[model samples]
Target chain A: MGVTGRAKRGKTEGPILKKCSTGIKGLDEITGGGLPQGRPTLVCGGTGCGKTLLAMEFLLRGALNYGEPGVFMSFEEKPDELVQNYASLGFDLEGLVAQHRLVLEYVYIERSEIEETGEYDLEALFIRLGHAIDSIGAKRVVLDTVEALFSGFSNESILRAELRRLFRFLKSKGVTAIITGEQGERTLTRYGLEEYVADCVIFLNHTVSDQIATRHLRIIKYRGSSHGTNEYPFLIDQQGFSVMPITSLGLDHPAFTERISTGIPRLDTMLGGEGYFRGSSILVSGTAGTGKSSMAAHFVDGACSRGERCLYFAFEESQNQIIRNMRSIGIDLEQWVKKGLLRFHNTRPSLYGLEMHLVALHKEVERFDPAVVVVDPISNLVTAAAPKEVKAMLSRLIDYLKLKRITAFCTDLTSAGGGILEQTEVGVSSLMDAWLLLQNIEGSGERNRGLYILKARGIAHSNQIREFFLTDRGIALRDVYVGPGGVLTGTARIAQEARDAAASTLHRQEIERKQRELERKKKTVDAQIIALKTEYELEREELQQAVAQERLRDDVVMKESMEMARARQADAVPTTAGGKQGRGGRKR
Target chain B: MIAAEGKRVHNGDGEQWILRLYVAGQTPKCLTAFANLKKICEEHLAGQYRIEIIDLLVHPELAKGDQILALPTLVRKLPEPVKKIIGDLSNTEKVLVGLDIRPFK
Candidate 1:
């Protein structure tokens, strides 16, 4: 069939691109609906950059989420070690094994005792892999750091040949394989295996820039597939590795036709219409005490009031603390919690790894299946991980929520003088779909809160900053009244203005006083300059006289030497007479 | 078990006997097949019994090994030899009857 005609025919036959869901939250979006099915993908990374975690998560998600059996061939860690390592993340590998959904094989190659008998080949290894794959009929297989085969044999040619054979075998067997390679400096792998035998190559990097270490993943190459080319920041928390491929979703996903309220009518009015679109991510960034969390809670209450489930993940406050604080502002989340429409996931920032946090979030989201998810203060999460990791996690979380059509609202705490759109740690400001900025503005001798919509994707939002207030009733928005300075230059700017006024007054007084002192000092300096110039001229004349004296001394010395030589020659006149006598004696 | 046949031949019984031996792999018990057959021929059968030795290791595709599921098993086939013996063929009398070589009364 002609290519275009075949493609047109394939449209009626459904998608020919077979997909294997990565089981990771945002990874599927970056991979264009996961890794290409029945092909080996090379996942290469440095130690602890989460190659193993990603592999395990792939297997776990395959078994648990997709009902596909998986096999894990570990070269360094045993099955028990993997099980124990993933226990905290709540991935029960052993349970999966017992359920016949997963299998783990440890391939140990002892370099000390390995004697090459000239008759052995990699056929035994292949046999064992085949046996494991057949035993469970695994559709997904992960060989964690298969480069250990090189440790037992110094023959690079053999290792390369065998690995090529292995990849071909896996491909022929129609298993989606992930062979992890240890990342090397300046290269994807030690032996550059990524260049040879694989259909895809993914590079994982754990870089520490500005003292904040973050994990990032990049899809270097994937044959016959279109993938996101962005370097996705990933988090390794208690859950596992979650790549945040934010803003990479196609517009083909179903959109909500309904508009939801923001719980507070005045705040809703500030949204230029009524609330945000369902499945949209709302980022609320502000300095401390700007009522960002309170605004987020207002949205959560709005969702709960409508009988929709809302999940609140608080990184900055405990459930009781949030409830108590919000109660003073008339947001009683306890009632929603009692009605089973609201759930709170409060965790300390240092409690787990970034991937673990992603896992926890995944589990909570899966269990609750809330219509709205709120993360109060995503900035605290940034403290636990790098900016890239936080962005990656947020991307995954956002993608997961978008897939489920859940509206997500997250609050980020920014420094007092920082811009609303600038991210402090990893600079991931471009990833947010909708950004809201809250500030404490100084008006009429008191600090009044202000709100502004910085950016909202796919929707028109007001660019004007609105004056807002938080009271016992709830959050209220008012019309922004611009004064001498622009609106939204909040209390810090006022404080700076006041400080500048005082400093300017003091500066005028000080400058006058300093002007008087400078007049006196200048008079003294002028006198000194005059005296110094006079002394400099006198010193110059003295130096000129000294040079003349030295020249005269040199001339006198030269004259004395010349005169002495002349006197010596005159004194040697008897010697000339002796010479004449010797000459006459020689002639005789 | 019934006593089916009794035969005694000093020089030749004019009958060929088929024998089979089962073994797991190359082990001591698997190696003693030739020696045991030689002793049985020199002492009892002389030129009467024809013995065939089978190594289960090389010919695992053969079904006789799994049918008995015994290692180092010997089965006498001819000269009315209807009995089977397991183990290393150490006991001579049991093996003699196992090959239908008991003395006639």
Candidate 2:
């Protein structure tokens, strides 16, 4: 009796914010660290976009990962069929049920068999759901496509009213819920139920363009919190749907305190004093056929030689092709691949959406835990996405790499005649820590390749454009050579050399022409100087005559002043006394 | 054993008996009856009698399996079929009639 009273008090307190961990990878991030505890999140999507899978993953992960009991109310799928569908994904639904941690209720309603029983008020459904949830103490609830009730009943008004009431009832009871709805061709939800009664709405889209299907999920609205707004592409496989948030990681990753070599001595010299920080991003841009792949291969081999894992994602070459090609250049990728230190994921750039490629990259990176990640040519990825999308994906990739403290090397293929210094395909060149530009310069009737360090963020890098050659010994960089012209590319350097020679010949002709013009100007100045000197002497003689006339007038004035001064001295005595008396009277 | 007016005979040898149970109709109150007697008879007397099921609507004289105080009654007549049960055979003694038990003696 004592315990009974306390238990009653607990029940009246209602459900606290019950949280269900969505088993979906990266989904929790978009959900502001999972759906509001005990509140229903409406998941609406078109057919085959993994709406049900998402709901099931939420329930499964709740039971498996978080020790929270769950209830799945399926109106569309039978319990057995639902279990079978998730079996391939390694979710043991039956085991969870047997252990009493999960409950699944299959509500079968045949519309034809149903009579106009106005007395039925979904009381039976409430009883069934209530029993299932209470029986398992379920903290998570999933109503899989509850819209089936609309099919069973003809009255839309009653269905809407009841659905709202049901959501309110579940909320009042305090169960964290996920309610899935079908998506209409033009509407966010088939029944538009998602527009009402739910606290959150997520839209799942399966878009096919150019014969490639990609699944994208966007949080349409989340009340009381902030979430990522971009349409993040996800993958549906044996492990269920995994949402790859294109910008989940921000730019505030911890900088690596230690430095690591780039595996090439010359390349390392270009990166600061010796090497780059372990987790920094390196951008290598060049025109076609400038050995970008070779540089990446060298990095991969470098990481492998240090007994560290390296992941190479070659968008334009197969693993075997890359390994074989690199072997000829003395970069033995095959040996590293055999040692399990090197993992190669080579696929076409157009194989999937930008987000799908990112998800695949993320999955491999997570599984391998590699020290370095090499994208042979990230430029090819731009073709599959818009410039903005490519930027978002690359930002996410770089952020995730920094979080794992993994060095990332990305190669970009610039177009010919576009100049040596070109922006990256995604416009993320500013985000890179070290940027390297490779070009083919033509010099002395031959094309020589040059590599230069554009910017290294945190360290001093070699500014010299060093001459590099792909020989039998691998990538060897010759010392900085100051040739006739500036740094060279294969054909451009030779063209510049010829242009410089022609410029020198034209300079000599111009000097001789200037000397002849100077001689003519000097003779003209001599004649003008003699004419000006004669005019100067005549002007001086006229100025002297004027000066003599003014001097004669000054002599007559001085003689008159001397006679006046002698008369003033004879009357000086009496004048001085009179002047003193006048001064005293004026003062009084 | 002699046969006289109202005389009865007791035989040590097990012999087959004929019994009948009656009911007014398939009313809810009268439905428990035939099943009750058949179950008792099968358990006590297996392979001993050929039970005849009779309805009074067809033959009123064979208000058998017991005395007819209610719609459902029972009467036994073989081995002199023995006695009759009345009032829907709600009593156990009235059901012993088909087993040849004389409660009056």
Candidate 3:
């Protein structure tokens, strides 16, 4: 950090606006590596919105992490009060003050005492700040509610002019400073300090939505550096202030070719033989009691089998409940939980806002370093916030998971009170790389669960609607049985198969009977044909004999005639006229 | 009003001791300053002194007029020269000496 700061400072005489890291979680990323270095950032908020804490954290973390001493000038709270208040967050203000690393200058002005009697130049405050900065060589300053001092001043113009001068003086001192202010009725701050300090302005808001309080931090405006403009939800816990910057890291995640199983072999088959892509997001959408959680448990068990970590976020069920429930289904999730391979994070959906869940989810994912993440029935989040906020939160969550290359499988219980199937209130399927839709096909006095892949972005996935049954062994998907009745399921399929088998047997018997009748008729026709052929042969033989006898008799008569003719011709050779007359008589 | 001469307000007829207390509102410090100034005046100046309490929040322009900066500043207008003491005047010796009622120890 010092190197970066020195590089920026030495490059030019003009202040090179370098970004300083605020060490607080998500704040640096939100501000694209923190506030502008050596520039005063205006931190304004309403009462109880954590403005002072924000400022104090910037200075404390600046000292702790970046090795830069900081100065805290409190205009509202006394130094002791500031120290006591921040002690809850592990910020050792007194220790730092004793070490001369942090200088706490309490500049509490009595609202009823101080009179703006003259055109004062704020020289006293400036002297104190310069003195503190010099004493510690501080590089950061926190002016906590500095505007409160203006309440004693009746002269608005001089105070305004002096505040501007104060920021410029701080900038010139080359200290990155945060000035806290009360939220104004119409402007960003009560006195509109934002108009003067334009380098950066942050707004902290604490509002109760649906009886649950949520704290939001937004970078209202940042000059010369790109910052997250969205209102990020933040939390104040034992670790101080943490702002959840949803989607501050954009959607440019590295696509991975690695794949993990969906826990169930059939499910893997449905998802193109392997599981989801390593960095892919898969959504299991189904109706009530469609084995979505079972599918998730299977995936968790599979990850645990691979000796990889898995984080299970259950919004609707507790850890023990999930473990016990999954145990009943032959998936011994408690074993993995005991093995520390699976971590269950359970929270009530109505406990906080959607962003709060997102923040918790991000923290748990990071803490566990899970290879796969499963949020059972993410559709319950629809109850946590507005549909749009829920979808936005989920989009951010999915983007984060994909960026980490952790295969994520989230279940959505497509609410029963819907007109369509596999339609979640959040409508997040578009962001998913694979969608496995489970449905309850209830017919013929029974309900059967069916699982199918609606789409798999890559690889050849089965288009068959497989009937999945949950039993003591686990979930099993039946092979697709598509007949003339299209896709069949449950007893109807069994019944139809029975009917088809019976009809085929009957058809076989009918065909055999017809074949036997055809054989008998062929035998009768052969006998009748034999009898007719014998009679035809006898008659043909008699006719042929009669024709042969006639031919023989004709031949004998011709031969005799030829002999007689020859003898007559020889005897009557001399008498040609008589021979011709005898030949004509014979021809007659 | 321009009173370059401090005693001109009394017309020099045994001159009324004029003391002005600058305050923002009726804060505790301002009340403390007022009480101390009254006690000092009652012990020394008696009935011959006139005290003026100017709330600067009511009149901000007066600040530029008198060149005042700190809060609860007690200004002595009489005795030819004006002297100022900042804070709630909690240190009585400092306040007494600053007002020229007594010399500094």
Candidate 4:
């Protein structure tokens, strides 16, 4: 089916169904535009469900914003009471009346004073309403709790007939009207006035869940128009009624590639050396005392240091408490607050329902128009609503922040005992663009904080776990030190590092001893070679001297032998010893 | 109605009943209601009653004073405790009872 119409500001289209803007935040989008134009819409709810206020706001907004005159005919409250009630909400009803832009008609009825005698019609009511409308030339009308007529009159059939005529008369006069009724147990309204005002039906509900009052608005039906059927949570505070349409926003927010700092240089290094992407949702989850708030403070500090506005929502701590605590860690948040670059919104989770918290966050973000938003420990919000609801609210919030291209840094406190520190109980981890898991590495009789990037989309983040310390200076991330057991931290890492240093020293001493032993062995081998060379030289000299002595003796012997031979009648030829000559001849 | 009106004796200084009949215009129901109210006042109240006709169509703003919603509404203005009766006074017995005249009769 096609949409009946879309309400555009200051513009109209042809033939489908023309819409009137309700001039309410997040309401016009849900109603597909506004109530079917020039037709009476039935708004039914239980007492104190804001039906009267809704109708009054419609008429007031019509008069103020849409430049359309309005007439408010109240059957439940007096004009003075209404004016006073609306005055607190900053609506100038009396001023509007003075300007002839609005007319407030109070229909007072006392059943005890009236006696019904015979046949009659509610022509006076019609005339009164018509006169009020004509007096201002109103294009919008509000009959707040018109079903009160049922109690004041005895004839139901005539009242019903007249109500039908009243609606027709309103349509004929081209005045878009809102007719409120008290909710019935089964039917949409007590008097079944929905049957008469069939053009549109809106149901307001004020229900208490876990003792938290949440107001919701649902469009039951709209003739010739399509409207949001989901019950959008609405808030009625000083700003009046504001409906929050959870699924109204689509996933069409523009993506930004700009990166911002996470405040800690090492943490930024872990996140691909730059920080979170602009317009990204960052989740920093950890157990208690794991410095989740500190991480968020750093993010806010980073944004403010860059001269960008930051909105910090502290659920667990007050503004002064956070400021003082961060000051202890050497981060002066008060200066940022003083400079108007940082804003702290502190509220307890139990102060409102999940939707109310979302509305407040939305209001703050819109008012501040911050470049970065930080919610320190969103896990506290689980106490206000269910995990699923918290996730839904966070999803809408992240979507809103992303649409505005605001960097959102939210800290979540994971339950410690038996609860996985890696798992965010609210299950909002998947909704975040970057998730930093802070855990307590309990070992060596002490607990130490460890931080690791679980996920960082579109960036190459570090996979190593860095031991983080919350020191007096700031949060410091140490490089991972793997020991015999695992990644050691605190004194265990220190002890292991000390042991490694000692072992390296022993190794250096052992190498020095081996070098001395090798030097001694080389010297001894050199001395032995010198001694052997000297001994061998002496032996050779002695052998040569012996041969020389033998030779000299032999010569002396030959000379003596020759002289003997000469003396013994030896020939003139050189004589040799007979035995020597015979031996030489025999040897030859 | 005449017998009942004659049987009651009017008492007190505020006994004069000043009734105002509010109507948008001269419709049949308005005329019938005015006629019936006049006849009932003359019979039941005699000389102690007075009827005032207020056309809401002519003086529409005056309807807020009597809190008039239905046409041809009768309001007992002069009595100590004012009373209001709605609808055309077709049933004189009910109308007399509403006016607190010949109520038991």
Which candidate ranks first by lDDT, i.e. highest?
4
Q: Model 1 residue A195 lDDT? A: 69
lDDT for each residue of candidate 2 in A1-588, tens digit (9 for 90 to 100): 989998867765765333345867889887768887767899999898988988888888889888989999888898899889888898888999999999877776555433231212343355456667877899899999888888876667766777887888788778888899898768877788775645788889888765667788999887756788889878877677788786677667899768888778977877765787889999999888888988888878777988999999989999999988888888888888888999999989897777778878888999999999999899898778776667878888998999899999999998888664567767989778888898776665777788888888888888888878898768998754465565555555545668778999899889988998898888889878877887887888888988787766555554555456666666544434554565467547
For each candidate, the DockQ is: 0.01, 0.02, 0.05, 0.66
Give lDDT tens digits, candidate 3, residues A413-451: 886757598576688989898898888876667888888
Q: What's the DockQ of model 4?
A: 0.66
Q: Which ten residues in a row have the lowest lDDT in candidate 2 chain A?
A: A112-121
* Local accuracy by lDDT, each model: 0.75, 0.75, 0.81, 0.88
Span of ten consecutive residues with least summed lDDT in model 1 chain A: A112-121
Model 2: fraction of native contacts: 0.00
**What lDDT tens digits, residue by residue, belong to model 1 across residues A1-588?**
599998887775876668899879778978888988998999998888889889889988998998889999888998789999999899888999999999888776555433231112354456567767877899999998788888866556766787888888999889998889998788889878886655789989887644556678899998767888878778876667677665585445677756678787865665667767777778888888989889988998888988999999998788999999999998899999999999999998767666567768878998999999998878888767766667777776777787789888888888876554355344545656778888777655667788877877766667777877677888877676565655534464556567779999999999999999999999999999999999999999999999899768756765665577677775544434554565567547
* Candidate 4 to truth, TM: 0.83
Residue A431 in candidate 3, Cα distance off native in Å? 2.4
lDDT of 4 by residue, A1-588 (tens): 134334442134546777888898888988878878888888999999999889989988899899999999988788899889999999999999999999989998889888998889999998899899889899999998788898899999999899889998999999899999999989999889988988889999988878888888999989887777888888898889888887777789999999999999998888889988999999999888999889988888888999999999989899999999999898999999999999999999999888889989998998999999999888899889778778878988999999999998999888889567778989999899999999988888988889999999999999999998998889999976887687799999888889989999999999999999999999999999999999999999999999899768767876786788778885665455564785467547
Q: Pick the candidate with the highest TM-score.
A: 4
TM-score list, all predictions: 0.57, 0.65, 0.80, 0.83
lDDT of 2: 0.75
lDDT of 2 at A26: 85
Check candidate 4 and list the clashing pairs: none
Calculate model 4's interface RMSD in Å. Answer: 0.8
Q: Rank the candidates by TM-score, best first.
A: 4, 3, 2, 1
Candidate 1 docks at the CAPRI level of: incorrect
